[model samples]
Target: MLISHFLHGPVSAYPRDYVDGAHQELHQHREAQLLYAVCGTMRVVTAQGAWVIPPTRAVWIPPLVEHEIFMSGEVRMRSLFIAAELSPPSLQQCCVLAVTPLLRELILRAVQGPQHAENPLIQSLMLEEIAGLENLPLHIPMPEDRRLQGICLALLRTPDHPNTLEDWAQQVGASSRTLARLFQQQLKMNFNAWRQQLRLMEALPRLLAGESVQSVARDLGYGSARAFSAMFRRLLGENPREYLNALNKLSELNPLL
Candidate 1:
């Protein structure tokens, strides 16, 4: 069902808390949305892909894009709804955005349900921040082809599996080259790139839940913690330990963040 509410202006904020394991069934909104998790993590699934949003990140979804949300833990969700007409070309597609300090404060202020006259400046700043923010590499695009879909689903179920594209090709009745071409043509990425995204998606919640880096690395099929840390740093600009430490430190220092 569609879960929408009337917005009083071009931008408005909705803040709500969720319990652990909460699930929002498939729904759509009349306006575009920025879903932010202030303290915990969330998994957002859209028709195009899935994104794991930690406290430091948020997802931008275009108006009327069917999606569902799964809360990873006790979550404080702060969301902003923008009038569909105000959505920019850059944000027309569903993607994840890195929430900076300025943006975080803006969201908190907006969530106070500010009056219309006083909202013009805040709305402009929020929109500008969102438009200028770069998309994070937190998305896992889903391929439309049934064969590729099967492979993607299986990998999600057993992300630690060491099956290569060639191995999957043997099992799926397609040549390795064909599988490679399908991934590129349909997912806009190679097999390895897609798998890397999948691994990152799997790692975020585990790390947030206090799993050891070494254990997470081993469970996710990495040869060692060092190798996993290298990959994490290359993609997210921080090693797993550093990333988790920063998040924990921030959480201790500020509740709004």
Candidate 2:
């Protein structure tokens, strides 16, 4: 059985832990939900495919689609469920949005306020903030090949390990040329692209845990924080520090934090 917190309106906030191997399935509500990861990570699987939601980002669930969320760590989720009529059409689709300072604060404030049906002002502010969600290009792709999956798991286990495709290929008993070809064919991306996605995924959890940008960069095998920041801006259109600061402000506004 699935557990849920019911609010007076279309919103809810609570902590959750899933121990059963069964995925947490929810047939989409009539409202859009902004799911923020207060702690730990959530793996969201939908018809569009699966995406890992680390702490630094939130996943937006639009109305009426079946989705399953799996937890990797203890999860504290602050879920903002908005009425269908009040939400933006764009948010009607499931996607991961980069939470901004203002939007995050708005959510925090809304969560702290009374969950009365009469609170139209809070509801309006929630809708406005939902409209402001910025789509991010940074996303993790599911690996198809068993060998490639093995390689990725190895890399994730040792992110700081400086190893090229050739090194990984040697360990996997495949040539670098073959591994590169398989990555492009199965993952629909090249080696560097896959590596960048993995790095970004790893960076999110660290950043959310309050690690400094320099520390995260170094941990992810980047030579300097500046280089890491440049890649972050190029991919997600924001600096690492700016993203963390926005989350910090959100935490400040939320009494639960």
Candidate 3:
């Protein structure tokens, strides 16, 4: 359903909690949204792609974009609904944003006070912070072609499925060459790259839940932790342990985010 928020100002903040396995059905609002997971993890799915929001990260959703949120564990979500006019032109599409400490604090402050009548100073600071946020490479683009969509959906259900493009092509009734072409044209990546991204995205929540690196790697069908670590470092610029360490450091500094 399309929901319209009657905001008293340009920005309004909201806080909510969700338990493990909770799902927010597909919905959209008139205002652009900054969906932040202060704790736990959230997977935000939209028409174009899916983005994983862990602690210290948020998804910037442009107005009128249909989406759904899936919680991996207990989630404390802090949301900011900003009027469409206040949304930055450059951020017309949904993407994950790196939430800095200041931005996180601004969000908390906004939500702690009266939600309807937002403080002008905090609203100004929050918008400024949002405009300068760095976009993270946490999105996995979904394909539109029916053949590719079928294959992608099946793989998402089982990320560890060790199916080559040739294998998927046979299963989907398309030639391997044609499937490769569609992957490049639609997702801007080869099949292997896309699958790797999907695996990593799926791995994040489990890792945050205290699953060991070796366990996650084995569960994801990696031959060894070394192979998984190499892939993680190559794509995310850090090993799994290092990535978790950074997030832990942030938590130690401030438990709020």
Q: Of the candidates shown, which would achieve the greatest lDDT relative to the real structure?
A: 3
Q: TM-score of each candidate?
A: 0.95, 0.64, 0.93
Collision count of model 3: 0
lDDT string for model 1 (1-257, tens) is 77875466788788899999999899999899999888789999988889989876789989999999999988989888888999988887888898877887888888877673138888898888998887888999999988899999999999988998999998889999999999999999999989989999999998999889999999999999999899899888999888888877655644853
Q: Candidate 2 versus the native: TM-score?
A: 0.64
- Candidate 3 lDDT, 1-257, residue by residue in tens: 89765456788888888899999999999999999987889999988989998777999999999999999888889899999999988898898898988988888777775742377888898899899999877889999999999989988999999989999889999999999999999999999999998989989998999999999999998999999999999877899999999887765655654
**Per model, how many backbone clashes are there?**
0, 0, 0
Q: Once superposed on the true structure, which residue ranges of model 1 sit more than 4 Å away at CA?
A: 116-118, 253-257
lDDT (Cα atoms) of all candidates against the true structure: 0.87, 0.69, 0.88
Evaluate residue 78 in candidate 3 and report its C-alpha lDDT on the 0 to 100 scale: 85
- Which candidate do you rate higher for TM-score, 2 or 3? 3
lDDT of 2 by residue, 1-257 (tens): 23334465655543344442336765556556678766567767765545666554688877656778877655666677655565687775667887776666655555564653236765666667667878765555657677888887777687666888999898889999999999888778887877787788778766776689999999889999999999888887779888667666544554454
Q: Which clashing pairs does model 2 show? A: none
Model 2: lDDT equals: 0.69
